[model samples]
Target: MNAYLILDLSINNFESFREYIEKIPLFIKKHGGRYIVQGVEPEVMEGDWCPERVVILEFPSKENAKEFLGDTEAQPLFSIRHKSTTSKLILAEGCS
Candidate 1:
């Protein structure tokens, strides 16, 4: 089954976050993952929860997604994301 990583991020510093935006995709690609949706403001549908930026990534499998999450080389970029934005992320498997 394919897996997806969905992210809801609120950026605090775009200047600092730029590095993560530019570099993290390379890490994702290394792990057989690709961006399905890059950062974009979401439209609120039924809830009061508002998201500043949203990103969705697709991978061949859940394991691939996990590996990407745990990739050692991406740690620095992850740090940049942590420092620049408050983020909520979830990984879900698609129907087989």
Candidate 2:
């Protein structure tokens, strides 16, 4: 089965977040993850929930998704993201 990492984020500091945005792609590719969606505004169809920005990453499996999240090389970039944004992330298994 595949896995997806979904993110809903509100940016606080764009300058710092830019660094994270630039650097993270290399790490994502290294872990066999690809961006399905990146920093898109949500369009509410039926619910009251609204997100400032959303990102979705697809990986080969749940373990691969976990590995990407846990990658040591991406730790500094992750810190930049953490400091510059308020976000929620979820890892979900995809139907095969």
Candidate 3:
């Protein structure tokens, strides 16, 4: 099955987060991942949950998602993201 990485982020440091975002395209390319959604505006018609930003990345499989997350080359950029935002991330298999 295909896999997806979903992120809901609330940014505290916009400038630093911008830097992190700038670096992500190249990082994703290196890791064999592609952006399905990046910083997309979400419509919550009736919900208590209001997310600041949402991102979804599609990978070939769960193992690929894990490898991308665990890549040493990606760690510094990921650390910047960690420091700049509060985020919830999940790796899930996509339905056929």
Q: What is the lDDT of every predicted structure here?
A: 0.95, 0.94, 0.89
Stretches of model 1 off by over 4 angstroms after superposition: none
Give Cα distance to truth, residue 57, candidate 1, Å.
0.2
Which digits, one per residue and each the tens of the lDDT, describe model 2 over residues 33-79?
99999999989888877989999999999999999889998999999
Candidate number of the best lDDT? 1
Q: For candidate 3, lDDT tens digit of each residue in 8-28?
A: 999999999888888878867
CA RMSD of all predictions? 0.7, 0.7, 1.3
- Between which residue pairs do clashes occur in model 3? none
Model 3 CA lDDT for position 11: 91
Candidates 2 and 3 compared by lDDT, better number: 2
lDDT of 3: 0.89
Q: Which is superior by lDDT, 1 or 2?
A: 1
Runs of candidate 3 with Cα error greater than 4 angstroms are none
Total residue pair clashes for candidate 2: 0
* Model 1: per-residue Cα lDDT at residue 3: 100
Name model 2 segments beyond 4 Å from true: none
Ten contiguous residues with the weakest lDDT in model 1: 40-49
Ranked by lDDT from best down, the candidates are 1, 2, 3
